[model samples]
Target: MKQTYGYQQKARQFFAVLLPIFITQLSLMATGFFNTIMAGHISQQDLAGVAVGVNLFLPFFGSVLGIISGLTPTISQLYGGGRQDKIGFIVKQGFYWAMALAFLFIAVGWLAVPRVLPLLNLEPKVHYITAHYLLAVSFGIVPIFLAGVLRNFIDAHGHTRLTMCITMTSVPVNIALNYVFMYGLFGVPAFGGIGAGIGSAIAFSLNLLLNVWVVTHIEPFKSYRIFHHFPRPQFSEWKKQLGVGIPIGSTMFCEQSIFGAVGLFMTVYGTVVVAAHQAAMNFTTIVYMVPLAVSMTLTILVGYEVGAKRFADAEQYIRLSRVLTMVFVGVLALLLTQFKTEIAALYTSSREVQPILTGFLVYAVFMQVSDSINAPLQGALRGYKDVHVTFLLAVLSFWVIGLPGGWMLANWTAVGPYGYWIGLVAGVLVGAVCLQIRMGQVQRKFSGQEG
Candidate 1:
């Protein structure tokens, strides 16, 4: 007889996995929150500079992170299938790939960002700050990628809390560094907005160190000997991971770069609009951690179950996660609606920016609801290793539909800045519908195979 899961049993397990991942995601998002808040307090120009800088960096970073993230599903499946011995060697290959990619990312950012920022015709001060910020943050790229590999390995083993503890511990350190570097405390010269990058670099380094400590010294993981017997780079292993990773990375790039593209486009709307846009984007992103946590957790669980050939259980996990995400996001929408003013206050004190920021938050409630549906479905599909089609879908939704539509509306219509967000809402809804259908097809295929 095949093992079965009850609703209550599934919910317990889901929360067990989801809570740690949620806390971990929150801790990670908090670092960005600190960066934004600190820069905002410095000055509107500083805040806007940080916004453009981060917008330039994150899409590329998201792509790199997405590629590295391929390790999680692969590792989860391997662990679930009882192929524990192959895990360490695989992670070694992932590390090699991460190092190579880190160098590539730093090179591209250094070479390309300066050349590109000038094309946007930003304020001279903002442009200078943006350039320096990316330069400073570049130092942390290698450690961030390496830490990503280890964190994925740990999370794949259902050890999310360990990574959470590691990340959470870094928060205070990140804040202290942010304060000192941003404000020039304790004899340190204030680099202003650029200091946010420096603080983040040091924090990323700290995270890497802590991840190394945990994997090397902790139970279960220590036995894997991930640090021992390092294997050389293999093209075949790279191909396997890249095969899954590239599409995922491409999809992430499309989705994230749209915002970056919008930020650049918003340059014409003036600095105040750009600052408000970033603030709104920042808060929505923090709220997004909830569904993102669900998505990530589903990826782990569904991948594990699929690897174990437990198709029914995998389906159950997907269904439960979607429902839970809906409920959570609904509550968040209420909070966003009720406390829009307070939330805006958290990001900036600018009277000019505050009302605009609050309006954007209203739009976020809709965007996030669609994202609740979109994120987890993608997570479930990734667990099934159904990535290529989703890549196409992402391009269609975010680029073919979202970006062009937003541009037209923003330029040709009355919506102005809000037009881009409306396009986001439409794009995500389309993606969600398409993904829902695609997920159904995958489930049927799996269910038939099981039958």
Candidate 2:
């Protein structure tokens, strides 16, 4: 009875933190879902264009988010240690890091968009629309980075409900703006696929504003005085964050860029393939949010336990997170496998795209289990500040092993796109195994056991 009660209490605590972060992440992801679905309505070319543009941008933007995510564990540790006074300093440093990354990405977008677009050899129409979309969305890069930093700070403190509310508010705003900008409603010029970019920029700007308001006015945040006095860049702190963050950022870049590379590679096969890939990727991404959220929650919970010097509790949280993630993903994979056709239809009305989408989901179902395992383990690793090994493994698994295998299988074999997906599965499985081993090493180290 005592053990059962303890497990129940832990489950409750886990969900209490997980649910809000999950909902917030879902709302954030909804922006992409809205963009993709609405773009699909315009034309298949538009859909492909939006898909390519978003994928191309993800490596840059996602890396920034991952880099700033280093702040979360740091903040959680400080919060857990009852060192609230130090939290403000860390957040101030995060802002500097965010702005630097934001500008760096914008510059990369300027140079790379022109050079990289031609390399893909995309369809002329798709290429033109994708370029415009990229240009427009580039405006939002700073706001997006700023929002990520704020969200990380809020989440680390376990004040996730406010972030959820702020992000959820953006969903409707984005959807409405997407409809207006995409269709040229309210006498606005129809930007077509580019409208999705415009809508996202506007929505992200609003998201930043709302987050700032909350952090400044909220009771929980007032004591931190994050905005009170701006501090100069502390080289020591910056070095510490970068040490932890760059590896994380690089790992994120590896994962997203490979997926983005897959999207680009599909363009060679033509629009139908690209559209099909987008539908499958978008749907799977939504499903992925479940494990992603659980992973983030694990980082916070474990970081708190570790900071408080409760190594056993941290280990327990990691175990519970892995079990919960696997179970949830297993159920989700089964459902997606069973209902893939019906689900594919939700993304587009085109008969051609639906069948291809359903086919892609077949691969997606198997990939989810590997993804579920890898994501939570990565999060648990983050809580331990064990980032470099994950980064090294990510490069080995995704770039060194996965990308080459995917390219060879996709271009050289009869399997076509299925081959690319198979490579992804293999890479994720390898990464999951590697990350789990690393996590176990950390656990042993913390327990003062020799490996």
Best by lDDT: 1
Model 2 stretches with alpha carbons more than 4 Å out: 1-5, 42-48, 120-128, 266-277, 340-359, 407-416, 448-451
RMSD of each: 2.9, 3.5
- Shift of residue 228 alpha carbon in model 2, Å: 0.8
Q: Candidate 2 on 104-183: residue-level lDDT in tens?
A: 88898888899999998999999999999999988988998888888888988777788889888987898899889999
Worst 10-residue lDDT window for candidate 2 reads 1-10
Q: Candidate 1, residue 368: CA error in Å?
A: 2.2
Instruction: List pairs with backbone clashes in candidate 2.
Output: none
Least accurate stretch of 10 residues (summed lDDT) in model 1?
A: 1-10
What's model 1's TM-score? 0.90
Q: What is the C-alpha lDDT of each candidate?
A: 0.88, 0.84
Q: Report the Cα lDDT for candidate 2.
A: 0.84
Indicate the residue-level lDDT of 232 in model 2. Answer: 92
